[model samples]
Target: MNQLDIDKMVLRLNVGYNGFKFKESDLKDGELKDWAKKNNLLKSDDKQKD
Candidate 1:
């Protein structure tokens, strides 16, 4: 998909999540896990797996 379409999907997802708003870079750079860890968004088991 195009960037605009990806942006729109990210926007929609962020709207549903209340506090977390993910940037395209987060997904693109594979930093989502780190971001989630910093934000305390990951579960204890998931964190351990990482």
Candidate 2:
């Protein structure tokens, strides 16, 4: 999947499980990427290419 798709899934998980209130716009930055990395949802070298 792409970055946006990954972010959406992560957002849903967070909102559903952690009671977060983030919107789709919030995922435009690297917040979900960092969270996913910290939670091992992403690999250390999973940086996306432009």
Question: 1-50 in candidate 1: lDDT tens per residue?
Answer: 88655655565566457745544334443354455446554344332442
lDDT of 2 at 9: 85
Q: What stretches of model 2 exceed 4 Å from their correct place?
A: 23-50
Q: Could you give me the TM-score of model 2 versus the true structure? A: 0.42
| Residue pairs with clashing backbones, model 2 | none
RMSD of 2: 11.4
Best by lDDT: 2
lDDT of 2 by residue, 1-50 (tens): 89777766866686568866543233444766566545544323334431
**Each prediction's TM-score against the native?**
0.34, 0.42
Residue-level lDDT for 12 in candidate 1: 51
